[model samples]
Target: MDTLTHTQFTEAGLADWRDLAQGIHARFATGDFATGLRFVTAVGQAAEEAGHHPDVTLTYPHVDIMLVSHDAGGLTPRDLDLAGQISDIARDSGVSAAVEALVEVELSLDTADGQTIGPFWAALLTGSTDSFADGQVRDSGGRVPLLWFQDTDAHETPRQRFHLDVWVPTELAEQRIAAGVAAGGTVVDDSAAPSFVVLADAEGNRACVCTTDR
Candidate 1:
């Protein structure tokens, strides 16, 4: 159950899904609560049959699903298979995939001593030290965004230390960046275009627009 690389996941051609930091995500528009429930039920049955389950959120208008092999720490062939099955179920149910609506957000903290601060943040956020490992904090319940520490040199106070990592589908990255710019955000860096772009708000707070294309 080795983790699949981003390139491998992309090559799978899962048109309904986007590979994000946490896993491969997808959204299907059901247009109503009953329809969404039916879709979720079918997806659940399919997941049970495959012995691999996805995180599913069914709402009045849509159903969001994320697939990941936690034991492998990322996507694997099981995820790809389940994703295809889920997409097939969606098509059979006449639910349209809304890939553009898929997004994943993560919190990043710049710190010189993650070893010291990681545990503290993990305890505060997830109430367990087990979530603090390798400079990353992850909630098994998926109740909060993933938080990772970025190693940086020791610096003075009164500087920005926290920023957001916003993950979007590859096809929507440029459009998202453009919309941010139109909303008065500045593109501080595009040296990693199609991978990530740094954007700053009017007050200079920064966030990144990320895609899996790279």
Candidate 2:
């Protein structure tokens, strides 16, 4: 399936946002045939122990799971915490991918103490005053944001947290690296072992330009 990343959460894949209020999903690909069935049963046992039964689908090659709080609209903490435990169980089973892609996270902020700074941020960003976990207000949309507030220690300049991971077809790595630097992102370093390149986004979050050969 074509995957979508909602700031690391794809509704179609594995997830971390699980609660009595929201559903979660997880997917696993096995490296060998025999391991697949065993992994499923192990997952089942784990799920039952936590009093949460995940919706499961499996083929000879891959396993996919969707979990949700049938009661809530999106996701909840219970789902994510259990997902972490399940991942640990599968690691020893030798699954093909370490874990499925994506985690859905919600960032929270408190602007009361720093009203001026907070209002400025609100003007600059899409944040709203809607309340959420732990007395923090959140962005109105279900956006995964790395939030910040007025703090004495915060860098005066906006930090670079945005980065990119680019995967080019094998032989063209260096060419693409040059093009990336020319365009905007800086090529930080090269790891030939995994055939990956780390590039910083305009904002400074590091991303990879990897060929996925490993």
Candidate 3:
């Protein structure tokens, strides 16, 4: 299966889901443990029937689901179909989809030598260096946020090296940015508006508000 582009996925009319990072994600408010369990059970059965499984996390108040085609390295038609089915299931179960609560976070490091440092970070974060690929460290179990390297020229010691890449729905990017700014963070850069906006805290540490709109 070929991977679906962000534009294609957005055009698919999956109102309950958002494409973030490498997958499509959705969160449903189950409101209780039993309801969440039942919802998860139904989702499991549906996934089994479709032969495509989504990573599901059930908490006391909500269930989070993420679907991606690992073989294709991104979203595929199977994901879209499963997402639609899952949405229907949520409706039938009387669970409300909390689209606004869905978000993905990634860690990024500015590095002059990712090839040399990737293995160390990968081993430390995931207990295996095998996750290191294309200047990024990915936890196959999804236990940790994706960590990618940003190539940069070597600089002096004591400079900031790590920052967060927060992925949110495109429509929420500006709102999130505004909230951050209102909370004392400053917009350091917006030259890449709609795709990413760099923001810095009062103390100068930087992070990015990112979206898949690009």
lDDT of 2 by residue, 121-214 (tens): 4545554443222232345453434344323443434554333344343344667667778889886777563457777658666655555344
After TM-score superposition, the amount by which residue 111's alpha carbon in candidate 3 deviates from its true location, in angstroms, is 0.3
Model 2 compared with the native: what TM-score?
0.37
Tens digit of lDDT per residue, candidate 1, span 91-207? 999999998898999999999999999989999999988999878998988897999999999999988999999999888999999999999999999999989999999999999
Q: Which regions in candidate 1 have their CA more than 4 angstroms from the true location?
A: none
What order do you get sorting by lDDT, best first?
Answer: 3, 1, 2
For each predicted model, how many residue pairs clash, with residues at least 3 apart or on different chains? Answer: 0, 21, 0
Judge candidate 1 at residue 143 and give its lDDT. 93
Q: What TM-score, over all chains together, does every model reach?
A: 0.97, 0.37, 0.98
lDDT of 3 by residue, 22-137 (tens): 69999999999999999999999999999999999999999999999988888999999999999999999999999888789999999999999999999999999999998899
TM-score of 3: 0.98
Q: Give the lowest summed-lDDT range of ten residues in model 3.
A: 18-27
**Candidate 3 regions with alpha-carbon error over 4 angstroms:** none
| Clash-forming residue pairs, model 3 | none
Better of 1 and 2 by TM-score: 1
